[model samples]
Target: MIRGVLALIPDEFRRFTPRYLALVVLLALSQAAAYLLSVPVLQALFDGNYGDAWRWTSWLAVAVAATAVFGYLQSMVGLRIGVGMLRSVQTRLGDHLSTLPLGWFGTTGSGAISRIIVGNVREILGVFSHLLSPVLNAVLVPIVVAVGILFVDWRVSVAMLISLPLLLVVNRLANVGYSRSNQRIHDAASEANSRVVEFAQAQPVLRAFGATGAGNKALDGALRRQQKASTDAVFASVPGLMVFALCVHAVFLLLVYVVIGRATGGDLSIASAIALIAVSSRFIEPLNQAAQLSNALRSAGSAAQRINTFLAERELAEATAPVQLSEPSIVFDDVAFGYSEDEPLITGASFEVSAGTTTAIVGPSGSGKTTLLRLASRYYDVDSGSISVGGHDVRQQPSETLLGQVSLVFQDVYLFNQTIEENVRLGRPDATADEVRRAGEMARVDEIVERLPDGWATVVGEGGASLSGGERQRISIARALLKDAPIVLLDEATSALDPHSEAVVVRGIHELTRDKTVVVVAHRLSTIAHADQILFVDAGRIVERGTHDELLEQGGRYAAFWGERSRATGWHLAPSTYRSDLNGALGG
Candidate 1:
């Protein structure tokens, strides 16, 4: 447990740790000396040696004062180290998290991340102020007491020394299964937290589907599992506590019996026997205190393990000599990649979009259209082949340099809980208000602003929940326009909008992508029919490539897909028949 806490504390903070620990040991030794000094003072007073009693009494006073001084120093050093550990650990975790692969966040759900960042990080904070020094005292003070008593009563000292290892062995036995139980509780709690967040955030969809109550079912199950895990942990811990307690009591009784036997047999004086009792209690007191805090110690250990595991995760490797790009073209050269190696979603795929041209990727659902965009943006590295942007391989440039060149406007838009102007300004923090308003005009967000009570200054609320979907989409487009990056990536932005809003957004897309490189995943024929190039993806491979007219002439997979979409587009609801039937029957 001590090692676990030490591992969490940064290197700069650890230099003080040895000084703090050494002071705690000195404090314990002083305390043991004070307790032992009492034996001599009592023995001398009982023998009616007035001068000897006075001498021993003065020595005892000095020992107690030294204990006090050492204790104060120990606490001050501990507090300094504790406060440093808290600050350094949190800062280090943040820095490491920033370097981790972006896909790590997607694979590890928001709930688990929340647990590590909030719950587990909080657990590490308690190590210095709560668990560290007390645990050390519990282990160290017993050894100091056993050694001190050897100078006074070797017979009884042997019994106390023998109990130390026995108590430790029983402690290990008592904590059996606790580690697993503690981990289960942490996992279940993380799941519950995630469910609760999901339940709160998805209220609109849940209520629309008349499944608000059903959505609560996931949260309820997570909560029940958390509760059961806590209960099982408690039950699992009880036997160990009971066994440890039994061993401590038995050790105490053995010391008492030995003292009583020596006194009765005239090998020890009555005053010495009485002082031994006081010494025995001191020996047992620390062990009991430490035993009481075992659960907290175990919790600290578990927290360290979770944090260390996260810190060890592999980050995307950046270039030693980062490259710069002058063009905005994207090229995929025989790229093959997947979240896992065996089940590749895209394999042997190759394509290119020239600078300032639009290349549309069309495919059946789940055929890796979105994955292609992700790969181009370096969300995950390709398993084989190379992805290059602006004539430079992505791996050759720094992550920030590559990301700064691409502007992504996907179907699922996210807005911060800030005023409309503030959210748009995130695209380019230095943009003038005039530039922002012009971007808003281009994206048709000016129409949304005119009707809203707060206009451009209106707060979007968390995730733009206060606005309609079309309004949020427009806001996102305006943000992208303000960014004006060299490369723009779209993921079917108008696929789920009303005709009027779709037209407005299409105009926004035109303004945003003017003279810029573009790669779009398109389901709508309107977007696909006009693209400069189309890549038809099917079953983890690109099966066809051509312009709209060229593919139709070939009559391959793209032609078949185009024909299917045309039929779906031509269908409509039948006219209402009730009034027509009545008129016909009356011969009107």
Candidate 2:
């Protein structure tokens, strides 16, 4: 864990590692000089040499001032290093996370990632900036003082050194127990945070069900567990910490006894004994500080391990030499993939989407329809076969190159907490105001924007909470339209819209996909009646493939789906049928 923490220190700061070490050495020297300077001052006063006492006092003041200056510099340098490393690490982690597979995000909740990125990262800052110098001083200053005492009286110094091993044993015992408790506390805190975020996000649903109180049980339970864990951690470590404190105090007592014994035996002078007592008092301070810092180091070690694990997560390997796409078409040749190795979401999936054509995929909820679109977009790599876009394998092309070729509009739309215009502009960051306005007009998002009090400048709130589902969908469509990639993937893009809004969005999609390769996954059978090709997917395979009308004529899976959808589309509640059912139920 200490190694992991050290690894997080950026190389830029590491270049000054020698300077930091030198500072620590200087700090220890300054501390020892201040302590040692007291020796001559005490001896002159005891000898009644007023002139020599004044001279020693002057030197002692200078040593004290120098120590203060060095301490200040150490703090300034540590702060600068800590803040700089924090910024660099956060930025690097954010960039690296973007390159990881989307499946990783799904499996690891946002709450867990945010806790590491925001909370644990700050813990690292404490480890590097605030903790490092003090820990170094604690170790180095004591050794320097011990060496000085050795010259004063070797036997007394030997006794002091013996206490060093005792300090180590107690600290080790305390740290081992504290580390286990600290880990439990950290896990409990993370779980509590995750539950709070989940509850907050689901508040509207809970209220609608009139079960908000009941729904809070999980979050409340998590909080209780966190409280209990925290208490347990403190209690579990207190005994060992008490023992450690007792050991440290005992060492101080031993040092005092040794100093008195040496002075009485005539081996040490009165002034020398007095100086040793003063130095001994200062010496045990560093040992106590070392014991206190042990707990912080253990917590930091745990935090560092988590951060290292996140940093070590695997990313999709980019091609060393990327291949260029020859066309806008997409092809899947015996593609197979799964979130886990044992459960495949897609298998033996083979299909070809020709350039400037529309292909629609339809299936049941867990039939891998959306997964197919995700695979085509390279959100996840295939396990068994290759997925090629524009005659080049997607894995053979760079992510940037592949992403530039396709625009995806998923069923679930997320908008940043920014202006409607800025959200749309994300589709093409360099796009001009006029281009944004044009895309909005095409997607009919302009209608919604105009209704807002701030128009295009309005804040959308987190995830566009202020807007209706269909409004958010139109904005998403506008974004995709502005991107204008040659290949478009749509997953229930119009599912949230009313008939009129759906018609407008459909028109926008049609305009955007004109002369482009399009792959769509839709549950509404009516929406894809005019698709150039329709694939009926079931249980990770395309069970049927043909044009919509052709599939309907075959009377297979697609035909059955169509029949159910058509009946549902025309059916409505009848008063006479409802009355008959009510009477039957009542036996009237």
Candidate 3:
């Protein structure tokens, strides 16, 4: 686990490795000097050599001061390395995520992904910056002190060494329990984060329904579970830790007894006995520190594993030799697809849209209208058959190449938390100010922007929460216009707008789709009355297709849909009392 985390440290951080090693060596040497100084100082004092004892103490103080300087340098360097790696990894991960298919984001919830990127990465950083030095010192200082003790008296050293294996065994048992509990705690934390994000995002809807309290059940349960897991982790490991401490104390007592017995029998000098006893305390202190750090190590291990797993996720394969498109037309030939393999949402569907024509796809909810558009856009690969744009199979071209020729505007509009102008400019980052304004005017975005206090400079809140749905839709259209791609895909782009806003947006859509090969998954049948072609999708198939008037004249499924929609436009609610009186009069 430690090795896996170290591997994440990029090559740029290796420059600080030597500095850290130097700090560890200096710490161990200083510790040995401090314990070893006690022997000569005590011997000199017993012989009334006060001057010699003072000199030895002064030298030990110097070593300690030097160790402090080295420790400070190590801290600064480690911090730089840790923070640098954190930022680098985050940037790289974000870039990689952007290249992944939209399906990956949908499968991994935003809350879970955020927790991994922000929370788990921070934990891993703590492991590198704060935990590493203490861990290394704990291991290295003990070895240095143990060797120093051996030169004083091998028998006492042997007794001290005997307790190490027992302490290690107890620590191992404690770590096993700690690891299991820590994993549960980590999982619970991720779940709690997800619930918190969900609750926050749904707050407006929950309040409207007067069910905020009821809606909090999931988040509350997750928090309670996390608290219990934390408590259980402590309870599970504390007993083993206590046992380890007791074993260390027992060894300390045994060493003290052996030294005292040897001194009393005149086999050991008084100075040597006292020095060995003093050094024994130092030796065991590192062991205790190492034992306490076991839990932190376990947590870091789990976090690192998650990060590595995410980084290792597969990405969509790009063609080695990508094919270039010769036209703007789209052809779906016997295409089949599903979120899951066994449950196909689109099967054996074939269609063609010539360049510079408008084709509207109308269907009931969940009839695969959006799925078909998504496939055409290469958001997901088709399961069986080909989806070609401009005579080139989407899979035969690089995703970037295929995407560059298409502009997508969907019902759900997403805007970054940036100035309105900047959001629109995302379609073409290098677009001139004049070009942006022109596109915005064409898409009717300038009308909405002009109403804001800052006009184009106004910062939209996250996901454009500050803007109304229609306003956001206009901005999205503006972006599509600015890109000026040959093929435009619309998925009920005006479905969320009010009647007034829909009229303004429809004008913008005309400008965007003019002379462009367009495929619209339309919700409003009336809007597409003049469409060159209308494909009535049902149960994953194009059950009917013709011009708008031709389908209505055929008096089939499309005709029925048109009839129902036409009546729905004039439907109205009447007062119950008035309706009943009218009915009674008619009966009389």
Candidate 4:
């Protein structure tokens, strides 16, 4: 624990260079004043000079005032240092997280990362601020006082130094035990936080199942475990404190006894003996502070371990010499991928979409349709084989260049907590208000603005919770339209829309794709009837490929799926009759 406290000095003290040096001078001056004040007070007592004692008492007051000023400066400096270091840590952490492969997010829980970045960082700062200042004062002030003690009498100084080994042993024992407990407590707390996040995110589903209470109870259990671990750590520190207190008391007693014995023998002057006792009392204070700070240091070490673990994570591969794209032609050559090693999501999938054509992917659920689209956008790299945009391999292409050619619209749309216009402007931050309005008009979102109380400037709640699903879908399309990237990956982009809204959005998509390469994961067969090509996937393999009419003629997996969906839609019936049939099925 002492070693850790010492380690923070280089990283933390390098900042505030001038202020730190000033603080040191001020601390030394205050310690000297304290020693002198004790001398005058003791001398007055020995000679029964009450007037002289009061004069020295006034000097003590001045010393205290100076110390207070330095103390305030120390606090301000510590805060500035801690906050700056924290910001540095956060920036580096964010950059590292962005570089990490997408698969890491799914496997490594969000709660764990939150604990390391937020909770553990707080602990680290607490440890540094609470322990470091006192540790510095403890080592420095004691040496100055010890030198003064030696000038008064070498025997007194030796008496004080004898107790040092005992204090060191107590601190070491306490730190060893507390460190182990702190490590467990921190780990348990991280797990508990992660569970709470998971539970909250899953609450809607849990409520639907009437299992909300069960989830709450499970969370409570996790919290209980975390509390138990923390309590155990606090308890582990008690035994060390007991040993420390015993040593401090023994040292104080030893000093007083030796001084009285020497004075009785007439070997020590009464004035000097009195001063030595006063100085011994002052010296004990920082040693006690050192003991307390040792506990804080131990806990901080645990938190630091967690923070270092997070920082060590692999970052995303970055290109030093980035090349820009001149075209957007996504080609997948024998691509294979899986989120985990045991379950292959895409296997030997091969396809191509030229720079100005639309390709539709149709498949049953879990058939790698979305995975393929994600690969095209480089959300996750292909496990084996190559994906190239234009002539450069996607892996070698810079992120900036790839993003310039790609715009993604998916079923799950996310809008920042901002105005409608601002959300749409994310795709092209430099887009003008007129450009934004035009994109909204093309995405069929004009009606939505006309109905809204604030139109474009209205605030959207987090994730656009204030908007209806169809409205959110339209806004997502507007964003894509505004981006106007050459390659648009549409993954069930209209899944949340009603039939009319779906028609409008699909029309907007078609218009947008007119002279661009589009790869779509189409859920509704009606949306892809005119697509230039269709790939039917099953069990991570492309089973068939052709135009809609041609696939129907083939009568393979595509035909069977089309038939099932057609029966479900009951499109053959007249509009009114189909509504009646749907009502009958629902018992309306």
Candidate 5:
């Protein structure tokens, strides 16, 4: 348990550990010494040595006082260590989490992360103040008591010395299931936590499919596994507790029998024998505490292991000597990437968006359109080949240097539960209110707040759920406009909006893209006809590259795609279902 606590402590705080442990040792010894001194006090009274008894009583007072002093010191030092640990851990996790590849979140899940950061970290912190002291005392106190007894009554002390290891072995036998059960419980709990989040977040989809309540199998299965794991932990502990109890009782009886026999044989003085018998009862207390704490120690060990595993995750590597951005262009050179190495997503892809040009990425759904824009931003490094911005390899530039030159406005927009002005200011926190208002006007977000009761102070509930999708997109555009980076990456910025709102958002994108290098994963084929270059990606490859008219002249894949889209525009829906102006969205 001490090893586990030390392992989790950061390097800067390691100096405090020795001091903490030293105090704990002093405390344990003082406690044991104080406990054993009772023997002499009892012996003096029994023999009618009143003067000796008073002297022994003064020494006993010193031991008790020493225990209190050492204990107090240990607790103060422990709290300092724990506070430092908490700060270092939380800060490190936050910084490290920011550097990890975005895809890691998709695969690892937020539930597991929250478990490690919230639950496991708290458990590790408790080790210094709560678990460590008791566990260490449990081991140290018994050994001190047994060894110190040799001076008082050798026969009784020998019996205690012999029983110590036997009791330990029995206790060890009882805790065999503890570590394994804790791990199972940890895994089961993480799964259950993830399912609960999933069940809540996917309520709309689940309810749409009539899968609420008992109809949700994934949540049901996860909950069932958690229940079984908890049940198993309870059952696993019973046998160990029973066996340890029997061993402790038998050891107590043996100590009693030994003390009685020795006293009658006259090998032990009557006073010493009585003192030994009383100290023997006190010995059972620490052992019992240790036995009961076996489960907690194992639980803490499991938590430490989980925390270590989380900390070991690799983050995106930064360049040792980073270059400054010199231009606004983005280039991909023969890149190959995959979520897994064996299955490539985009293979041997090469493209360049020169400074002050707009390049549109047009492709069927799931054809790696979004991946291209993501690559340009360097969210995940390519498995093979290189991506560069401003004529320098992205890997040769620091993340801040690279990202500072780019702005992102993806299809999925997220807004914190804050005022409209606050959300816009997230793009440029130091921007004046006038600057934010200008950006809002350009993005047409002024229309959104005009009718609202609170206007700029109106809180947009979680993820902007209170607003329509178009309003959210415009607000996100306002954020991008406020940022005003020289390079922009837009992924279907005008998707899922009514025609009028779509037109308004497109105008905002026009303003955002003006005189800036833009790479757009465009859905509206007709809308991007004027793009300087078009790349038609299919099945993870850029199969066609040209202007809209040039691709049409070739009449190949791009022409066919455009032809399909043009024909799709003729299909109509009722006025209430959708307006005909949704041609781009419907045909995209």
Candidate 6:
């Protein structure tokens, strides 16, 4: 357990040695003083020296007081150290998470990682405190107690020492069982958390499908697993306690026998025999505490392993040195990517978006339109070839600088449970309320907020459930506008809006993209009729490219798509059903 603890402290702490050296000094002194004072208290009581007993009592009182003060200081020091360590961990985790390829999130649930940050970190803190102090106290206290026993009669001390290793071996074996049990318990716990999140996220669909019983049954199974794991963990500890109890009994017998034999041989006095027995108990006290600590240590060690595993995940690589941005155009040169080894999504793709122009990408579903947009944003590095944003290779530019130049608005929008203005202000957190209001106006969100009960300060529900689909999308656009980046990427931003709301948002995008390099993932080709360039993708390749009229003249894949779209001019029932379900949402 101690080895696990030492391994986690970063090199910064290791390099600066004075602070840790002082902590070690304080811990050693405190443990030694506590042990010496405790042994004398036992000796005075056994000798029946009333005056000496009173003297030792006063000394023990002082020792206890000193221990309390030292313990508090030690705790405060540990807390400071823990906070520093935790800060380092959180910063590193956040940085790594942000740089990880976008596809990683699709494969890994966000909730599980959230639990690692919040829950696993708390467990790690408790582990550090539990493992450190007990180890020093346990080691020092027994040695002091054994010396006092030796002064009375060396035979008793030797007998006690002989049995100590056997108890340690038994306790270690018990620790292994407990550790395995905790691993199962924690695994069950993570599954329960993941299931609850999944169930909650799908509540609307499940309720509509009338699968509440199935959901309940899933939760019940999770609960059953949790209960079983907890029961097994408790069961695993039973053997450890039994072993500790037996060891204590054996030590007690050895003390009594050694004292009686010496007294009968006229080699020990009655008072000395009693003192020796009393002191022997103190000698074993530290061992008993050590036995109990081993249990906590094992539990903590299991938690640490989980936390370490999470921290060990490899983050996306970046160049050792990065260059500055000097241009605003984006170029993809023979780029290729895949979500998995078996499913290639984009192959040998190439495109370019000039500054201050809107480039539309239109394709059938699963033609890599969205994947192409993700590449433009550097959410995933290309599997081959190069993506250059502002003339610097995307992977060779620092992530912060690359992301600072682009703002993305997508169909599915998320808002935190905060005031409307605050959610909009997230793009530029330092923006004033008046500035946020201006951006909201540009996104046509100000009009919606005016009708909301509390206006801009109104609290949006979690993930914006309190608002309409169109309303959420508008807020997302407002956030993007607030960012004021030179580049904007839109992924079917108006796909969720009613015709009226769609016009409003599309007009807003038109104005917002005026001075920016715009890349639009085109689901409705009509929306991008005025785009400076059009790229029609099929089977992960750009099958045609030209202006809207030019593509129509060519009569290629773009013309075929346009023909299919023209044939389906009327509204689809599913969209109408979805809008009806939204209850005439302001943006829907």
How far residue 394's Cα lies from its native spot in candidate 3, in Å, is 2.5
Off by over 4 Å in 5: 206-217, 573-588
lDDT score for candidate 6 against the true structure: 0.76
lDDT of 4: 0.78
The root-mean-square deviation over C-alpha atoms between each candidate and the true structure, in angstroms, is: 3.2, 2.3, 3.5, 4.5, 4.2, 5.2
lDDT at position 536, candidate 3 = 93
Candidate 2 per-residue C-alpha lDDT over 8-27 given as tens digits, one digit per residue, 9 for 90 to 100? 77878876656666776788
lDDT of candidates 1 onward, in order: 0.86, 0.84, 0.83, 0.78, 0.87, 0.76
Across residues 1-588, which tens digit of lDDT does each residue of candidate 1 receive? 657678877788788888978888888778878878888888888888879999999999999999889888878887777778777777777888887766678778878877887788777777766666677777787888888888878989889888998898788778876767998999899899888888888887878877666446777799999999999998988888888888898999999999999999998899899888878887888888787787778888888888888888998887778675778999999999877767899999999999988999998999989989988988888899999998899988887788889998888899998999999988889999999999999999899899989999999888998987788888888988999999999886676789898889889888888998999998789889999999999877999999999999999999999999999999775566766877799997
Candidate 2: pairs in clash: none
After best superposition, candidate 2 residue 158: deviation in angstroms? 0.9
lDDT of model 1, residue 454: 90
Best by TM-score: 2
TM-score per prediction, in order, is: 0.93, 0.95, 0.91, 0.84, 0.93, 0.85
TM-score order, best first, reads 2, 5, 1, 3, 6, 4
Q: Return whichever of 2 and 6 wins on TM-score.
A: 2
Q: Show the lowest summed lDDT stretch of 10 residues, model 4.
A: 1-10
Number of colliding residue pairs in model 3: 0
Evaluated at residue 195, the lDDT of candidate 3 is: 85
What TM-score, to 2 decimals, does candidate 5 have? 0.93
Superior by TM-score: candidate 1 or candidate 2: 2
lDDT of 4 at 54: 90
| Model 4 RMSD, rounded to 1 decimal | 4.5
Clashes (backbone N, CA, C under 3 Å), per candidate, total 1, 0, 0, 2, 0, 1
- Provide the lDDT at 180 for model 2: 84
lDDT, candidate 1, at 244: 88
| Candidate 1 runs further than 4 Å off | 44-73, 208-215, 453-457, 577-588
